[model samples]
Target: MNKRAIIIGAGVAGPILALQLKKIGFESEIFESRSEGNTREGAFLGFTPNGLNVLKEFIDLDMLQEDCTPGSIKFFNSKGKQIAKLDTAYQKQRYGVETFQLKRANLNKYARIAATNAGIKIWYDKKFVRYHEANEQVTAYFADGTTASADIMIGCDGMFSEVRNQLFKEVSAIQYTKLISTGGYAKIPELSKPLDSIRMTFGKRGFFAYSVSNNGEVWWFNNYFREQQPKPHEIEKTLKTEIQDHLASVHKNDDPLFSKIIKNSHEIIAYPIYDVPKLLHWYKGRVCLIGDAAHGISPHIGQGASLALEDTVVIAELLKSHKDYETAFRIFQSERQARVEKVIKSARKVGNTKTKTNPIAAWFRDRFIGFFIGKQIQQLDWIYGWTYSNKNSH
Candidate 1:
């Protein structure tokens, strides 16, 4: 009998993993919580060189390139003073691939197409409720009262994963970083010049990042005011106050694009930054966790999406090369755990700077970051330089 795998959650990792498994001659079925074919609620995501390189094997790079903005990252202070600029193109020269800033909905659509082209069956509205693994087969139960059994189960079901909770009695608690993030995409009615660079401004109150995403939409995120919880529909309800306060404290004056983007945003999403402490083991028996479920890195380094992309390819490769699931699972954790832990730590350190509780600490943190901008970017070379080879490079 042919090997069959069932994946929960059809987000970045799940669908990408499905395609990779199909290439390795394994059959896969993806169960997603949302309804089919609707990739709305647009958001922007940056694909570092490492992410783009791995994804190129499964999908067309040209299609992805067609919908991305290739640019360098510019860092600045609260007074609109330039700090240090970093070259994203360095990844291309070092790794033979370029980083891209794309819209989240566009990337999701492309990954879905890749999975479908690989003949993977994806069922929508099949929210994962529970699962059971026997000696030979693993059975997954869904909230829709449907059940499917496969040889192995992989849960790519994002940060709040049902599969991870069902398998482990105590799920690793997500630590609240106290920082609230507000982001939305909108058209640039006018620009001082044609936007071609990504900019990040660090202020006393918080930080703001802006970049042009695919389809000529400007995507911006403001992170500040460590808070307990967000109000229901907080993005729409509190965006005006939040953006105004952020601008008032930082710039002390209104700018055209910032004001227009925040006021005119049709869909704004607000969420607190939560991270799971690194887990020692990512798999048990015939089941394994991937993406945010396995390791929820803070978005400070902008590596969450890239990490998910890496997890999908790594998990698929591990399953193909190892005969025994036990050995494969252990090796997978061993090989990836250190690298992921390092990234999680880096992201946490970065997020911590934005949330410095003490005034003195905040000053020191800002100066520290400004001083080491180049060194920090260089440290990421190990991550952006990684490649998936037929043989284990580690």
Candidate 2:
């Protein structure tokens, strides 16, 4: 009999992991804490070439494109002058895919649909509270006091995973990067023309980004610096006008586009940026972790969705190649640790650049930033150049 797996969380990572496992002859069920599957409250996400290629395993690109937009990228300074742009033609020609992006909710919808089409069942409202290791199976307890057992359990829960907390006695895996990310869907009424790509700006105080679709719809995000971590209420508070006014101040000297985009947003979503340092362990016995549950790199580099998809493909591949779960789990950690940590490191460096508030530091960054952005596209080759298979994930 094939070993059954229990996947926790029905977010992007959980559904993709389920489909990948099915491709490898393993069966699994996804348990999500939310009452239902899809919603439109979250922000947008970008999947680089490497990530999109892996997702192509079970999803059709055309089907996904219907929900989200895929395009190239251009970077600029606060003055609306172009700094450096990704050679999209070169990226597509070389990597077999370009940057594809959509809202987080839409991406989850697509992944869940794909998983369902492949015959994977998703249980809603099954909040994973904790787990217990048994002689031959692991039992997962949900918030409703219900339980389920499987030969293996994988946590795709997220950065603040309860599963991860249970695995380790103390909780030091997630570290705050001292940044608050905010974004929303809007209509850039003043935008003279539609854009088929992402436009990023590095200002003296914050990092601002926006993408305008061909039909005049806009999806934009901002990363602002906050010296200390916020309280739970602050993170959950809804203060659109207040946040927009603050953004107006931060982007006061930036292009009028920045302030206009902020004012245009119908609603704003906000969250903290955090990263998971390399863990001492990824799995033990019949339980393992994947996706953000294992690594939560900051989104500065736009690889969060892609890296999670890569994790699904690799874990499924490892299971197919190994005879037992023990070997599979061990190899999974060894193979994934190095690549993901590199992404985290790169994101940290770029993210810190957005937090520069000193006059001298801002001057130094703005003057020399072109050099860094020039090097950025070259470094992306290493990131978007990756290709994986169930036969050999590397």
Candidate 3:
């Protein structure tokens, strides 16, 4: 019998997995809670080489590059001192690809369209309420009273995953980082340098980053923990205060980049950061968890979407080798768990680096890490340099 897969969530991983399955002559369907292609009001998403390569296999890299802007990332200390500048060309040489920044909504729309064109069916407003897994097949029950069955089920439903709840017991749970992210777009008459470079400031108040989007909009964000109790209108009030404080701390009072950007800024949106510590198992029988559903990495690593795409490719490659569902799942979990655990640890460390309240500690941490992070960054070579072949080779 021909094998089929049921994918949860229509986010980055779901559509990509469905597309990869199509490449391997498997049929798959995606179920998403959102009724349309619009995303949940996300800002810019940075696609590292690891993610770009996987996407290039199915889509046109040149086209995506043209659609988005190619940029470099610059790191800074709390006092707006340039710590280091990442070389995009060197990264391309090392990983065979370069990073690009694109709007999260547009990227999702593109993936959704690509999946639809590849003949993958998507059902909206069909939230998976539960699942019944048998030795033969896995059936999903949606809150809309609809039922569907497939040969295999993969959950990419994100941190608060229903699939994880239905299939696997709570081996771990999402932990709040006490940090909040607030971001919005700003219209610029003209940027000094096309705003192609990312500027990040690290401080005791927290970390703030501002970069130009492909559409000539300035995308800026500030991350900080609440000093006191949060009221109902706390996030909104905090956003404005934080922005004002961030600009003042950076001595950007007269800088056109800061003044014009904030002058044209829109309403800010905020959300708390959450992630699972790690999962011992990502699968049970015919159902498996992928992306944030299985191991939700912090945005600190800036690898969440990239990791999700990587999971899709790796799991698909593993499944091709094993004829038995259980064996395939075991292989997938064993291979992914260790790597994900390392990433989770590294991400938390990076996040903590920005939250040190002591000025001396913050300075020491930033400078010490910045001067010696080349080795640490090189450790990521294995991840970004990975690719899949038809022969099931690593």
Candidate 4:
């Protein structure tokens, strides 16, 4: 029971996995490529019941919910006409936890704190270069010329994972979905009333979404079609003014509030979205992939973070019950691949709805979207209601 493991990337998956592994007699060391205090890239994300249940095992739900807004979503057409709504309160009644939205930085901070407090070591600035698996052990090589070996190695390094690349050299590259998302927080006093729902719009030129937290901060984002994939450096070098201008123009015709939110936002970040192709295998020898490293989904479904959290629980549970690491890794992939692929496919379909559409199609969508949303909610019972303990029950 004194096995040691190496987890790459201290993102949502790594820290939670470390904590879960610790509970089952496994010592884990997490290695993150970025240096400490560098978790300021992404905007906010949603936490569904499935993901929250996993976090609740080690972290306080109230602490995670603090400063977050209710995740109930309201949809609208270009003219600002309400189209549909998701009753998250009903979801809470069904799943035992309500959905909420919070900044990515806050979740990262809390997760790392929980892992470290539980005595798990996290090594920052240790970019994983490659790993060598032999004879029941895996040795992870870092870009900093340091090496760490463990009985098992897990990749939580995310979409462009070096671990996944090294694991399957012949696999196809991650696919760019040709969509650019930009968002930031803004202080809009007049619009700061807690709406208890994220307002989403199918704008004339793009898709926009916004919500107000109890703390009076307006959290918002927009998605637009980008035919060519943006370069990493290009996204990094893009100025806040440029993003603000672009968003202001895109959402100009939809709602005045959308433009106001953009004008007031001091900081804006933009990045092109990418999707990971299906893998034939998620594990090899003593090393394995989990979370985004294994399957990356679009943000349209709001299941990306939640799915990653679910992976941590499933893998940890399997590793504890299985006799060998190889068996556990195989079962983990088998148990997860189909469900994750279903989610990835559904997310892609949802993302497609956000893209540019003809006026006729948009008109039909505005009217019928409510019915479709209601059906989707009924279909999502399996996702929100799922739990690691009931894996076999399903």
Candidate 5:
């Protein structure tokens, strides 16, 4: 009998996981809490070569590159002096894929379209409440008074995952990282020309990064230190104008270009950064967690989406080789836990640099930032060069 899997969440991991499972002759369904076609939830994000490789299995690179731009990052200090740079062209030569940046909504749209074309069923507005395991079958209960039973249940529900909460009963697993990020899109006439690389500035007060898309739109974000995490209501009620004014003030001491970008942005959004701490386990019974549900990494390294993509590929491959669902889930955790934890730690360490520092420390950082960045880039082969091979697992 073919194994039937019930996937929670319709985000990046869930849909892609469904497609991968289908390729291996397993049946799967995706349940999402959000309504269909309403994917405009976040700002733009970058796709590293590792993540792009997993995506390319299902999506054509040319189709995914539409409206996006290849991203080679150029770093600058507060005084607008170049400090370091990451060459995407060189990255392509080494990793077989170039890093690209695009709107979050566009990526989700492509994933959904690909899943639908593959004849996978995705149920929207189905909020997962809980699940039960008995008689070697796992059944999921939704808020809509419906139930779905499958041979295995996988959670791709993201950072604040309900499935994760139900599995471990650990409401405190997700922790705030004492950082807030705000970003927006702007159309600057003078800066309309597209550049080969994105510009990132370690400003006096915060870290700011911006890139020009293929269509001449400037996508930018600012990461700032906040001692206290903002209340959810506060974030929701804050007006775009208020955020713009605050960001402009934050970067006032830095280059004048940041001020111009903030002033010209038509809309702005803000969110607090959060990450999942290490868990003792990622599965129980026939239920397992993948993606952000398993380990949530902050945006400091731009690997959150990529890590999730990697999880899907690994889990799908493991399930294909291991007939026992429990063994498959166990091996999945063993294979992924160490690498994912390392990424989380790296992201946290990098995030700390964005926080407020003393004058001496700041000066030292500015003076030696390029050297540190160069060393880090040299050590990135393990990250960008990772590829899954089923033969190696046995």
Candidate 6:
């Protein structure tokens, strides 16, 4: 009998991991807590070269790029003065592929289509509860009262993963970083005619980012530093009027561009930012964790989805030698810990730059951001330049 793996979550990492495993001689079933209807409608995501390369190993990116624009990023201060630009389309000459922008729903949609075409089975609305590992095999329990037996269990369920809660007893839990994020889409072709590039601003009040597409579709988001996490009910209350008025007041002392973006928003969403702390263990017995469940990084660096893709890539490669499953799990953590931890730390540092409230500190930040970070984009080559191959792994 072929080795069967049980995967939790059907989001970004889950479906892609399912495809990767299926290609590598492993049969797997994915269990998602959400029914299909709710998973769609995420705002937009930057799919960098590193993540795109990993996805290319399983499916054609051209099929997905038709809906996206080149992923060039230009940094600026609150005054709208350009600092530096990372022209990802041109950088493809150096990194083999360029970064691109796409709605998260489009990527998820394509991943599901690919997984379905590959004969993978996904059980929707099956929320994971706990797992039992005995006799060297693992069985997973779900909210729907169904069970699955597999040789390996991986948690790809995002940051607030129940799988991590059940398996990783050594760690307390994923912690909220007290940063509230809000984003929306707009149609402002006149103001955002330059669709080839993404514009990011480090403001005195907070951090703001916006991008325009050739067709007048604009994607934008803002990050605010909060001292306390908002309750579930409060989060729901940050809808159109509240978000618009709050954003208007926050930028009252600064540029009006950010206010314009907010005023033009079709819809807005607000949520607390969370991150996974350093883990003493990523796996125990026959079950392990992957993606956001294992190491949820803050979105400051915009590499969350890319890092998840990288995780699934390495896991699939290591799993090729099935008899040494324990060793695969062990080595997977060893290989990934340093990289993911560094990213998490770097994201925090990036967050700090956005939260500067003092006038003197804000002035210093805007004045020297170019001096310090202009060349820093090149330092990220280690991330965008990575490629997966058995020869490279050794």
User: For residue 373, what is the lDDT in candidate 5?
Assistant: 72
| Lowest lDDT 10-residue stretch of candidate 2 | 385-394
Better model by lDDT, 1 or 2?
A: 2
Question: What would the per-residue lDDT of candidate 4 be over residues 15-131, giving only the tens digit for each residue?
Answer: 999998998899999999999979785678888889988888778888877789888889988877888998788977787788899888888889999999999999999989988
Write out the backbone clash pairs for model 4: none
Report the C-alpha displacement of residue 301, candidate 1, in angstroms. 1.0
After aligning candidate 4 to the native by TM-score, how far in Å is the CA of 72 from where it should be? 0.9
The candidate that wins on lDDT is 4
Tens-place lDDT per residue, model 6, 1-394, is 7788999988778889988888788899999888877764556777888888888866688877766655777787767788766666556788777888877887887887788788999888998988998887899999988899998999998888898899876683767887877788777546756466778776767667778765566778777666877777777665446667888788776677677778888877676788787778788888888888889888877788899999998888998854678888888898899988887888898787777767898677667766665466677787788776655454
- Residue lDDT tens for model 2, 100-186: 677777677778888988889999988888888877889999999999998899999888888888887475457777777878777
Q: Between 3 and 4, whose TM-score is larger?
A: 4
Cα-based lDDT at residue 211, candidate 4: 91
TM-score of the candidate numbered 2? 0.92
Per-residue lDDT tens digits of candidate 5, residues 310-332?
A: 99999988988988888989999
Q: Which ten residues in a row have the lowest lDDT in candidate 5?
A: 170-179
The residue pairs that clash in candidate 5, if any, are: none
CA shift of 61, model 4, Å = 1.4
TM-score for each model: 0.89, 0.92, 0.87, 0.95, 0.95, 0.92
What candidate 1 gets wrong by more than 4 Å, as runs, is: 192-194, 231-257, 356-371, 389-394
TM-score, cand. 3 vs. native? 0.87
Per-residue lDDT of candidate 1, residues 252-369 (tens digit): 3424446576666666656677877567678888999888898887777778778888887777787778878777777777777888889888887777666544667645645765
